[model samples]
Target: MLKTFRWAFAVTGLGLVAGVLYDGWTALGLVAVLAVLEVSLSFDNAVINAGILKKLNAFWQRIFLTVGILIAVFGMRLLFPVVIVSVTARLSPPQAVHLALTDKARYQELVTDAHPSIAAFGGMFLLMIFLDFVLEDRETKWLGPVERPLARLGRIDMLSVCVALGVLLVTATTFAVHAHQHGGGHADKAQTVLVSGIAGLITYLIVSGLSDFFERRLADEEAGGHAGQHSEDAGTGRPAVALAGRAAFFTFLYLEVLDASFSFDGVIGAFAITNDIVLMALGLGIGAMYVRSLTVYLVRQGTLDDYVYLEHGAHYAIGALALILLVSIRYEINDIVTGLIGVAFISASFSSSVRHNRAARR
Candidate 1:
């Protein structure tokens, strides 16, 4: 615990120093606020992640803590917003970069205006996650008539890819039609939406597919081992090798997917606070540290096992966030409120977990 606190403080202190150097006191304040927001909002994510982490091998665990940080800091904080600006705002990559750096004020306005689309992306993604979880839980025979066929349609992994692609096509067409009806240039809008949506979808598909592949492989290995003890021992050596390979791949994919999911909100929300690229980066980067530390804390504390319902609560929060993101496409939802909802659910779960522990002890 002492070591963990030291690490958290060290990383936070580093972020503070970086913010001060990059954008001074104002940036520092923004970072502080972002840190608080991230801590509050990401408890649900931590809970969900804890459940996943328990299933992962030790090697993957280390990668999640280390490489995951890089993805959050660089991929989400720096690259993601640039991609959004280039695609939706019709800014060239270089121009967007310049706008973010030089015309920070106007850039913020542009990004804020782009919130609807960002929210749409997050909402749909979360909806997919929620739906998948629901399908996994319900054990009804009637649904199997419909689900078995879909399940046989090459796994949920493949289904997700198809859904993501379909969404990209639909979103691009809708945006293009809207642009044309509004007397704006439809070609640019169509191209931008198509390209960006495809890019995001492809990233999601690749990461999710890879993660599923590894998880399935691990399960297969375990199942095969239980079938024949003699063969299992002989196969044990091979299984260990296979397990290590799969774990490494899964860890990389998990971090990438998680970072992408988190970015859907973090990048959009950052615009609400500041548009200065440096300030936005500083603020969100600090927030990322807290999220990462929280992930580690969940792992170390075995929070999921201690609180059986915690994962369920986190998934519920994820479902809510997804709905909120979808609504934000047409409406404005404050980031503070989003954060609070997640925090409230997590707090309730924690209280429940404490009661459970006490009851078990008695």
Candidate 2:
């Protein structure tokens, strides 16, 4: 464990040192809190990522740890929120950055105010992921009673899409009525939710579809002229071998988008700690580093195969998060509460995995 996390520890130390140098002990304290918040909220993300990372070869895995980490740190942590605010509040990139640096309180307000749309898009994307997993007819069934019926329903073409659209429409309608009653921004938020949710759904379909298409091609090639072999990779739900060429590229894109969806809430919730973009990036960046490292470690160690049910737990946690995000559009949900819900699912799944292992031994 120590060997795997050596880089994370080193970078975390540097971030903490920089935090103290930037603004005394108070900034250091805030950075520590923010890092904890990020890690707590994102452990399940690491699990899901590991399941994908193992499909890539050493080169792409290195890229994930190196280039992917940079994007997660700078692109999502620092720049993405700026872009969101710029689009939402009609400010330019420079102006958004200026507002963040100069008037952090107002900037935080703008970012927070944009939460409905962010939640809509991210919530729908994540819901699709969870729905795909739950709806698939996998050999392993964690929640057999619930998942079994869902798998039967998966026979219906695009059942997951239909379910996702149904949920989005209902949620948007609920929010539209609530916003009308409250007179918050005159129903603009309802429209934003509907638009963003459709965007999210479409984005998921395109990216995921492209990734699966490439993976099928890769799988076909690996099967050696046996085009009738399999529609998708077996076992890991990714390509059988480490993907290369076009396959790796699309899969990598999918992983980044998935990671971004998970980070949406964290970026917004970090304002509860401090609105200083620099400190927020430094702290959450540290946590992201740890999450990336943990993912690589899981891929290297074959932990998922051993645990078996861990993936199910992570997906269930993701489903919970999706619901929470949509619900929070009309009502605020505490960050601590959100974090605990994920941790609970993961813990329960881990315990179940251990029991299954013990029974097999018997």
Candidate 3:
């Protein structure tokens, strides 16, 4: 574990020193707090990433550790927020940078103001992930009480889509409208929210759909005339060496989009801690590195296979996070509440897995 996470620790040390050099101990303190906030809120993200990363080829896994980490740290944490402010504030990219560097308060306000659309999009995308997971026909029931019913309901074709769309529409009309009234009366609250929500749903469908399709193709090639070699590879405790080329690309893209969905809330919430974009990026970037390292550790160690229920807990956490994002369109949920809810679900699932293992030992 220490070997897997050495870089994250190194980065943490370097980032703390850089923070102090950049400002003072107060800046260092805020950076530390932000890093903790990110890790606490995103441990489930690392678990989910591990589940997907294991299926990927080693080459791609390297890419995830390399290029993917760069994207997560700089692309999502820094540039994406700038892009949001640019588009929403009607400024060019350079101008957005200037605004962020110059008028931190205005930049923060614009980013927070754009939260409604960001929430709609990220919420729907994550909701699709959780819905498909729970609705899939699988026997590895972590919470059989809830997952069993969800699986039964999966019998209805397009049920997940229907439910997601219904939720989006209802939310657009209700919470979104209320937001419009309170949120400076944006020209078309329902329209903006509905459109962003649909975009998110479509994104999930395309990215996840293509990834599964390519992976299935890889499995067939490996198994020849038999069933999925993806499963066969898993049974043998080896990655499907063929998860490269197009399959790797889409899987990589899927990971990035997934990271983006996980990051929207965190980026906006960082303003509460400190309005400095550079500090926010530095702090959040350090935390993101740890999540990435944790993901790699989970994959190499096959922790998901050992724990069994850990993935279920992570998905449940995703479901909870999705709902929180959606609800945040109207309400202001504290970062602490968000972090605690995820921790509770993950902790409970870990306990359950421990019990299951003990019973098997008997």
Query: Which candidate tops lDDT?
Result: 2
Pick by lDDT: 1 or 3, better one: 3
Predict model 1's lDDT versus the native: 0.65
How much does candidate 2 score in TM-score? 0.93
- Judging by lDDT, tell me the better candidate of 2 and 3: 2
**Model 1 lDDT-worst window of ten:** 135-144
Error of 1 at 36 (Å): 1.5
Q: Give the runs in model 2 whose Cα sits over 4 Å from its true position.
A: 179-186, 225-243
**lDDT (CA) per prediction:** 0.65, 0.90, 0.88
Residue 348 error, candidate 1, Å: 2.3
Lowest lDDT sum, 10 consecutive residues, model 2, at 177-186
Question: Compared to the true structure, candidate 1 yields what TM-score?
Answer: 0.77
Clashing pairs in 3: none
lDDT of 2 by residue, 1-362 (tens): 89878989998999999999998989889888989999999999999999998998888888898899899999999999899989988999999999999999988888888888899999999999999999999999999999999999999999999999999989888964474222266457678889999999999999999999988878666775365645345555654444446889888899999999999989988988899999999999999999999999999999999999999999999999999999988788889999999999999999999999999999
Candidate 1 lDDT, tens digit per residue, 142-254? Answer: 23465466445544554655665566566556644353222236565555555545554555556666778777766666676677542232534554456647756765676
Q: How many pairs of residues collide in each model?
A: 0, 0, 0
Model 3 residue 72 lDDT? Answer: 87
Which tens-of-lDDT digit does each residue in 250-339 have in candidate 3? Answer: 989999999999988788788899988878888998989999999999999989998999999999999999999988988999989999
